[model samples]
Target: MTKLPSVSVVILNWNGLNYLQQFLPSVFASTYPNLRIIVGDNASTDSSVEFIRANYPQIEVITNDNNYGFAGGYNKVLDQIDSDYFILLNSDVEVQPQWIQPVIDLMESDAQIATAQPKILSYKEKDKFEHAGAAGGFLDMFGYPFCRGRIFDSVESDNGQYDDVKEIFWASGAALFIKRDKWIEVGGLDADFFAHMEEIDLCWRLKNNGYKVIYCPDSVVYHVGGGTLDSENPFKTYLNFRNNLFLIQKNLSFFHASIIIFIRLWLDLVSLLKFLYDGRPKHARAINKAHTAFLKAIFKTGKKASKISTARFNGTALVNKSIVWQYFVQKKKTFNSL
Candidate 1:
């Protein structure tokens, strides 16, 4: 019998001992043949590494000297591992038993298909899609990221609405499945992003290089969203806003990026004001700080931008309309309506 390609499900952990205790068994339950489960610990002071070593003796543990955050941690750990495919999983996710093979089969069928993500549902709600990566990720004309099962803050119920296999602008970092070669070819996730939208930036680079990012509904995982950083945290807000600008800057042509970033600045100001109106001054200040950081980092990020081939935003899954206008002005709540 021909051996199936090897797959490594590398969970990047940082002070997520509870998550590991909760979800590792579910991940171990995956039925894929020729699989290896690894915990890439990012300098956790919480005895997470010790717990994994003691409890999950079969699982490989790689330790980083310092907390390199998500992007850098994965890059560091992945460098030492060899596999046909790599599933960069979050510690908080619970995988279905048969989650692995379907996606590997889908990816193996095509060389150009570089990255894919499983259908992500909320672990808390069960029936509803998760916020980070609902079904598949898509981008609007203004560079706003959304998902088939989620638009902005509105997450949809999983009624098999997005069961079809489709191309997407980005795959969620929460449970990102990537071809090992493609990952290395694109230089992995940008460490500069630190966290948030780093996967989107990587996906955009893949798209720019003439590769496909796909959503395979056959495999599913339930994500306990915001395990590392809560959604309401101002730091999460800063990363989202700042990294979004970094995403556009590094991917699009200067002319196109200029137009979109110009518009986004105004939209972000409105968001800042809304946060203040809602008595969330910290979040409002996060937006301000994010913009400030973007300005400061432009030159450094610009160097990275030059490395990528600037393709016009004509990818298959890129929506030509602004999701903000579609969701708010037209009151389109669902992905289908848009």
Candidate 2:
């Protein structure tokens, strides 16, 4: 009999004991033969580590000294574990027993397939796709991240439309499966990103290195969106707006990134105004804070950008047009429509 590849499903936790208690059982029930379940606790003041250690004695717990956020927390924990593959799962996700094998099989089939994600459905509304990553993640020419079953605020219900395995620009972080070597090659997730868009940045960098990101529909997971931060939180807005610029800056050429950022600023301004008009001034101010932070960190981010490979982004998943226009103006809400 052949030995199965060892896989580690590492969940980064920061004061999410409730999520851990609610979701860990489904993960423990994963039927993958060679699997290790680990909870990388980000110095949670809550009893998350204690709960895992007491209840799931077989599970491994690696506690960080301080909360390093998602990117840094995962990097710290993953560096300690040796495995053929790593699944960076969110704490709030519920998995099927067979979710692990299909993704591992897909990644193992292709040497170039660096990372992949399962079909993510909303835990609240099981019929609909989740916002973080619906089927597979894609990026517009301007660097806006969307998924097959989700575009902006609009999410689509699953109806076998995106069940086929396909290459994508980015895989959702909620249930991201990545090869161990590929994860290390890209230097893991950018810790500077802190959290939001970090997965997309990682995927973009992998694509830049001529690796393929895939979506395997055979593996599916339910994600309770906004587990760590609510969608309406201003800080979430800040991270999404700011880290998006960081993503473009680190992955694309200086000239191209500048052009895209220039256009994005105008588009963001419109969003800010819309927030103000809608009586959400906090969100409007959050965008302002994001741009300000991005500008301040330009020199630091540019240094990272300088290391990018000369290879241009030629991924099949990269849409050459603005998704904002497609969704809002053209009213192309569904991925098939777009």
Candidate 3:
């Protein structure tokens, strides 16, 4: 029998004591043979480190002095780990006993696959797909990412529509799996992103380097969406808007990036006005801050980190049509529609 490659499952935690207490046991119960479970603590003041050492003494806990957010926190913890594959799991995810095996097998079968994500279902609504990553992640022509089971805020019920394993544009960070060497080679997640869209950025770099990102629906996990940062937080808004601009600038060609960024800025202004009209001043301000930060990011980092030889987009995960127009104007809500 062939020996399984070592898999390191690292869960980044920041003041997630309740989530850890509730969900860590499900991880411990995972049936993978060659697994190393770790809780990389982001300097929680809630004695979460102490609790881990006390109750889950067998599991390794890599504690940082301060909260490095998601991107930096994973970069720090992963540097010390030596493994064939790494699963950057979120603290609030609950896994089944056989969750890791199918994904591992699929990835092992294809060395070209740099990253893969399991089918992410909602922890709250068990029958429906999660917002973070539904069946798999896909990018629109404008670099806006939506999932097979989720378009904008509309999440589809899982009726076995996306059960087939396939290539994807981006794998969700909630339960992201990547090869160790490939992750380090592509500079891992860009620390500048801080949090949101960092995974998509990483996957884009991997794809540029001639590797594929995929979805393995056979392996599934449930995510309690927005565990660290609430979805409604204006700060989340700032990160999404700012980091998406960074994503386009960093990956797409100069001509393509310029066009998309210009269009996105206009769309964002509309979103800001809608927020203000809805009496959400904080969200409006966040969008304004995002635009300012985006300008700074472009000027500060003039060069692309992951430069590719191709002149245009090569990945199958991108939807050439405008998802915004299809959803808003045409009233096509599901992924199958457009």
Candidate 4:
């Protein structure tokens, strides 16, 4: 029998104690042996702490005084993780009993893989695919997120659409597994991200170092989309709108980053015009603010690229070329409507 590697599963919670109602049982059902569960709770006033204490008494729980966003909150547990592998899962997701075994099996078979994710399905319909991630997350050259079965707003229902395991550009943080030390060596997630796009940033760095990222389609799970932000909220729109630029700026080479930046700016302007047409000027303003935030972050990190010791992939800068062809030349953008 293969020796199953031990895993420390970290679920970051920001005010979603109730999500725990649906999530914890499914997590406990993980069929993989030698597993430990830890919940990292951000400063939430919603009885989250009480829920954990009352229910999962034997399970370890860590608490913060304020919402550190996803990246910040997960960083806390990352510092303390000493297991063979570390798993980062969203509070809003429900995992299958057999989820982690295949992920760990694939990683053990290939030490080159730095991260792996399960096939993610929809929490609402169960047979449908989720919004954030499905069969592994891929990035357009412009840094927009799409998956094999899930383009923009349309999730290809689990009609065996993405049944194969394959290499991908990034793994969704929604249900991600990675070796613990590699995560620390890669510096974990960049806290400056506050929340969005941090997983792709880490996965990008992982791939840059000649490490592979895989999608283990056999390990399936259900995800309730958008647990924290309202689906139609303008703030969510702004974050999705601008964080693409942040990921591209931080990861891509200067020339490629510049090209993507220009393209993203143009797209944002068009999106703003669309928002204006839809009588949602507030969303347009939010997009403007997101852009401002990216500019501010760029000015702050511009001198710090060399300090980013994790980025070892300076080869052809693959993302730029792929994104340009898919979104610009091919004009086959997915997920814009979602």
lDDT, candidates in the order shown: 0.93, 0.93, 0.91, 0.79
Question: What TM-score, to 2 decimals, does candidate 4 have?
Answer: 0.91
- TM-scores for all predictions: 0.98, 0.99, 0.97, 0.91
Residue 144, candidate 1: Cα error in Å is: 0.3
Give the clashing residue pairs of candidate 2, or none.
none
lDDT of model number 3: 0.91
**Residue-wise C-alpha lDDT for candidate 3, range 53-92, written one tens digit per residue:** 9999989999888888899999999999999999999999
TM-score of 1: 0.98
> Residue 85 of candidate 2: its Cα lDDT?
96
| Model 1 worst lDDT run, 10 consecutive residues | 305-314
After superposing all C-alphas onto the true structure, candidate 2 shows an RMSD in angstroms of 0.9
Least well predicted 10-residue stretch by lDDT in candidate 2? 307-316
Model 4 alpha-carbon miss at residue 268, Å: 0.8
Cα RMSD, each candidate: 1.1, 0.9, 1.3, 3.0
Q: With candidate 2 superimposed using the best TM-score fit, by how many Å does residue 290's alpha carbon deviate from the native?
A: 0.7
Better of 1 and 4 by TM-score: 1
Estimate, for each residue in 110-213, the C-alpha lDDT of model 4 and write its tens digit: 87888888988888888887877777777755677778667666567677756877888888888889888789778898787777778888888787777888
The segments of candidate 4 whose C-alpha lies over 4 angstroms from its true place after superposition are 308-338
On lDDT, who's better, 2 or 4?
2
lDDT of 2: 0.93
What does the lDDT read for residue 303 in candidate 2? 95
